[model samples]
Target: MKDVDRGALAISAALAGVAGYVDAIGFLDTGGLFVSFMSGNSTQAAVEVFGPGAAVALASAGIIAAFVFGVAVGGVAATLLARPRAWIVGGATVAVALVAVLAFGGETTLWRVALLAAGMGALNTLFLADGRARVAITYSTGTLVSLGLALAAAATGGSRRAWRRPLLLWSSLVGGAVVGAVAHRGGSPFALSLAAVVLAIATVILAVRPSTPERRPAAER
Candidate 1:
């Protein structure tokens, strides 16, 4: 891979760690609802709306709405920060802060959780808009599917054999989740602290000069 892509991939890995941390804690505390995977939330909301009727429907709807709202905020932030790579790190910062508050704040509530979910969605949207294919650092459902497909391609005798990085991405996520879960077991705030640490590290990586940059159009360059 080119140096620029490599740099982006490394950044993505760190962000993946952040995502996994967020996901693990979100799952543990939020009654199986997933914030990073908005699809899951949306699907759950649909089930609540259609299956059990309007009784528990509002909960799923709220989660889905919060997730979408987070994504919108992230997309806007990413667009604004597109030119400067630091913006990606900035998104991470927001994620870490929001999660910390929701997880650790003494006065946190359900509404706070909803706000945190939106913030996570926003950080994830930043990753999406970054246009780095390997950097689906915020979500894993598609990453797992991609890994399986890539492995299948490799098994089918195609020379495209590019499973290493994708595997790395997968492992990073799982590892991060494990770390987050363990931390959460100790104390919920601990998981968010871990996330903040990872994001801070990612920010430092961005601050470092790149060996070589991937050239983009003048607008992005």
Candidate 2:
């Protein structure tokens, strides 16, 4: 977060919100499955393998595979495209929009969940620095860890403001999840459409904004 520019940080926060929103919807719709938090899905899969059956475990495995595939696609796009952030966000927008369409069309839950997971996978590629994602938008565990470290550093006379970004990211995700839960309860049918609209707007902003040059790690420099 300290290394990222203001514009990039804002975009990353917004993306995190989207991730939380979608994840909430997916959780409710699937009744315990996750769309973005692969760690949770992995644990669930492991438990299901022993508890429920292979068939239940396979669902999480499939979502994980889809996420990996989306990451591969986004990684290639990042390497090849001039405006990788915009294009990657655009790709995510498309995936999310498709989920909304399928939901309206009464499509099966499996495809919707898969697409949600894939969109989130692509979203994580939006802010790469030195061949790694600078921000993990869909998950809060890492952000919380960073927050704790930043707070510790501050107590030890490090930069006092270093914790702000991590806090902001985590707060945004929680806020989005709250909104998503309310929307899902009130307007369940339109919850996904709302997410798609948010992503579409983000795509436009990323497309028009000047690209930020990738910052290399100190060792590389």
| TM-score of every model versus the real structure | 0.78, 0.93
TM-score for model 2?
A: 0.93
Write down the lDDT of every candidate, Cα atoms only.
0.64, 0.83
> Can you list the residue pairs that collide in candidate 1?
70-122
Worst 10 residues of 2 by lDDT: 212-221
How many residue pairs clash (N, CA or C atoms closer than 3 angstroms) in each of the candidate models, in the order given?
Answer: 1, 0
Error in Å for residue 105 of model 1: 4.1
Best by lDDT: 2
Candidate 1: tens digits of C-alpha lDDT, residues 32-150: 76656667767776777767555436765676688678666656655565334455455657666776766655743556557656656655543342354324666677677777877
Tens-digit lDDT string for candidate 2 (1-221): 67677988998999899889988888888878888889988988998897756776888898898888888888888888888888888899888888877777663477679988988898888777667877878879989999999999999999898899999999988888888888888544588889989999998998888664543446743
Off by over 4 Å in 1: 1-4, 50-56, 82-84, 105-108, 125-134, 211-215, 218-221
